[model samples]
Target: MGKNFTYLLGMLITIIIGTILYFNLCSDCIAGSSNNEVEQVVTEQATAPEPEPTSYPFAIANGDFDYSAEDNFNFDLSSANLRLPVSEKVDFGIYKLKDYLAENAGKVINITGLYSSKEANNTAFPNLGLARANDVKNYLVKLGIPSSQTNTFGQLKDELLPLDGVLLGPVNFNLADKAEDESETIAALLEKIKTNPLIVYFETGEASINLSAEQRQKVADISQYLDKVDGAKCLVIGHTDNTGSRATNISLAKDRADFVKSYLVRNGILENTIESSSKGPDSPIATNDTEEGRALNRRVEVTLN
Candidate 1:
């Protein structure tokens, strides 16, 4: 009986060990299969293709509208009047142009002066075209429009039309982006001052203020600028037409400079910040032979520093 019991106990122990071994092996195999499945999922995810990115349209600087010169009116070159638009009733063209520019301050204006004839008897075409364009630019600047918003082009007639006189093409107005670079900004500012010069004209041989609306506007612009920029200085340079002797013109130029300086001071500009000088007829911008050219030559330039 003892022998039989010992044999049965040994077999039972062997069976228990076998059952444990089988369970352990099955668990390892199942774990390995699960690991393989996880790796396959990770590999698939790593090799999957990414979605494409969306693209957008490029933006335009001056908005989407197409702007051109067709929006503005042209001036009549037949009239000899060069004064700023007022009660003169000279022509509605300038007034219309001014109104359009005023309403559309964001738009850039291009004033092109066109001459019908290039005869020597006619006013120097270059000077005439320049003067007319300058006049329009000055008027706009006086009305508080920025000088950078305007440009001038002069076109003398290449071919004369029958009975056609000096005619100004329609002032071109278009949408333009603001100047981006420092150089462009400086250039625009310089052009602004040059086009709208503060010319304190005098009597034939005197140093009195011309007392015109144009002069008043210059004074106002200068005063406004001075007020806006503290510690700013201006150099008031006087000039003369070549109508008199050199010594006489130099003296007249000085007198004119003094008057301009006094005028600025009177208008609340700092006296110390203003410097005055004279160029006389030595720096005449226009020809001395013609009355109109001489008129243009006699002027004052206010340079801001």
Candidate 2:
């Protein structure tokens, strides 16, 4: 029995030692494995690729025209000129836009040109934004889109990021509502024109005129009206202050009216359709006793007949 007990005890001690050694070796192995895992994680993190730069896409869309995920045009800082990107997709998209507009009648395009106040305005337009939009409109017109079907204006944008000194897709295209009945449209246009007639104010002895975007649009609308309504006439009436003699004032007023007529004729309106006259100092919309009133008096009133 004692010998049996001694053998059993020796087996117990051997089993204990083996357990201890195994645990110690396993701990070391576990530690080594953990260290290797950490190293692998670090290596992977270091070898990972950097994220790509952000891309600004240029696109155009309308009712029938699908939005194309392609760059069409780019512009330099403070520039109104269009810089075409090196992509055939642009041409395809433009042709598609043109086709869509041609197929869809009575629909008009409104082009909004975005500009930053930080940019310089060097164009003859009222602002860089309008000039940019007008350039785009002109391009579309050259592409066979009717000038009457496209209208342009400017919008101020505070957030315009330029990539390498170039602005991508600075213009936006929106389709205006389809025209209603022809007579209804004409009546509405006439009401608007008469209620808010384009009154171009002039300085003393100044012949050059600069029109605002709204005024320019009015001129376009008038041109469109004259094109549609046969025998319609555009009357340009000039008024003056009572500063000079009646005859001299009438002559000055006549010259102003003639200048306005020329301007209208230059903008697609037929010269023969326009009639110019001078009211001299007889028709003053304001008091001629003050400078401000006199300034208001030196004006040309455009009306549709």
Candidate 3:
């Protein structure tokens, strides 16, 4: 009985050993399967696609063309209003506006807003619409804008202030005393000269008035006033120094007289009333021997028609 029991015990031990070996192999096989699964994962990862980078509408900065504002990437530049697409709005100062307008010449553009003098920065800006417009026209002509086509009209004329009171300092001339219409005043002023009430002169003529801005502006104001006066007419006369031949000097003097007449005529003053005559170097306001005297002798006289 003892021998049979011992033999059974040995068989039991072998069975136990076989069970342990089977479990060890099964556990090791499952762990090995997970390792193989890792290989499949790595293969899929190697074949996977990559994400694309951001792009832009136009050619972004490549160092060829520079940018005005730094850090373009931070802002949402998709909106048209927010992003400055062109160089149109760029300004170094207020004069650039005039420069731009002048460069464009006759091209009609909108000029808006009231630019005030004494604002420190915008003080030098023209206060009068016509003056500003004229300045713009002149500027554009200088900028190569064809002078023929250039015409400017102000949208907001009332907003402008008088330049004389501020930037130009106080206006000395009596703008009111001068006739409102230029043609009429030019006529009256010339006629006044015939009686010698209003003195006329060359660079240093017998006219006591200095050819300063005060004097010229007064003339201009009178010219404007004459344009407003009723029954206003322009009378222009020509004069010359006695130093030259009488016939030649008379002809030359007439030409000189006509030149002033022509300026008013071209600028909308009636030519019919603006009669031209040359007093040969015969009318000597001063002696013809000296250069100064000769200069004084070259004169144009105007009278009402």
Candidate 4:
């Protein structure tokens, strides 16, 4: 009986050991399979494709030109066109503008035609603004930029805060669509001449004003004012020094005054408003004996009344 009980206990111990070994082996196999799966996932992730970098089409938009912004990125044509006194036909700096536009052809552009109320307090201000905008648009169109790509705004009244005025007072420019439209007021016209006087000087024995490229601007400035100011009376007074014969001086002075008047009328100034007069050797601001004085005296003054 004792031997039978011991044998039975041994058999039970062996069976327990076998069961424990079988469970441990199955656990190890499961663990190894899980590790292999984890390594495969890591390898796949390491060989995965990466996203590409970003790109821009306007890398060469500014071209080879350099530009400075006084306020923001709005390119100023004022330096080339608006700051100077303008005539019916004046030098509008269009060439440099064209170069810039051509370089940025694919991009859209905005042109703000800036005007001042103090300088251009006439009904013609709006027209002037529109014309300037149109000028830029037309130029860009000619340079292969589509007309639809350009947006133009003409502001007759400066909306800038803190009064950012340039070159003193206002700048006026106009492009009239109709012939009979009277747009500028007398007060505005008088103010224009008072702020910016138009004085044409004459060479000795010459009655005609110089029409050179530089002088053309001066003439245009006066003519533009006259054109805008309808029925605006002007005293076109010519003066000469006591150098030549009194009668000859008088004739020269009269001729000079008349020539200026004719030029004004030809450039859109009304004929009846301009009163041509000569003050030969009479109104001497300086001594007529000196060449400097003579040069000063040999001048045609246009005063708006």
Best by lDDT: 2
Q: How accurate is candidate 3 locally (lDDT)?
A: 0.43
lDDT of 3 by residue, 1-305 (tens): 99999999999999999999999999999989998999999999999975332221211121322223211111121110112222232222223433543554333332222223333211111223323343333333344433333333323322223322322111010001112353564456555544542235665333222334333333333343343344555566677777647888777766667766665454334454456777677667789889888777777654443
Candidate lDDT values, in order: 0.56, 0.77, 0.43, 0.53
lDDT of 4 by residue, 1-305 (tens): 99999999999999999999999998999999999999999999999975432211111113454332222111122421333232211122333434555555444455555444444322211233443444444444544544434445556654422223233212222211222222344355467666655678888656555444434444334444543454556778888888878888888888889998887655434476689999877887788778998898888877766
Lowest summed lDDT across 10 adjacent residues in model 2 is found at 51-60
Give me the displacement of residue 194 in model 1, in angstroms.
3.8
Clashes of 3: 17
TM-score for each prediction?
0.36, 0.52, 0.34, 0.36
* TM-score of model 1 (CA atoms): 0.36
lDDT, candidate 4, residue 220?
36
Q: What is the lDDT of residue 273 in candidate 1?
A: 66
lDDT by residue (1-305, candidate 2, tens digit) is: 99999999999999999999999999999999999999999999999986442234546555456666557566788998877643577666666767777877677777788888999865545567767776676667667776656667789885887877888777777777555676688788888888888889999768787787788667756755664566788889999999979999999999999998887654435577799999999999999999999999999999898
| Ten contiguous residues minimizing lDDT sum, candidate 1 | 52-61
lDDT of 1 by residue, 1-305 (tens): 99999999999999999999999999999999999999999999999986432211111123544322211223345432243333223133344445655667565656554444543312211334443454555555655555556655555654423223423232233345434563465555445655777666565756555445555545444543443344656779989998869999888888888888886664434577689999989998889899988888788777776
- Candidate 1: regions farther than 4 A off: 1-191
Using TM-score as the measure, the top candidate is 2
* Cα shift from native, residue 219, model 1 (Å): 2.2
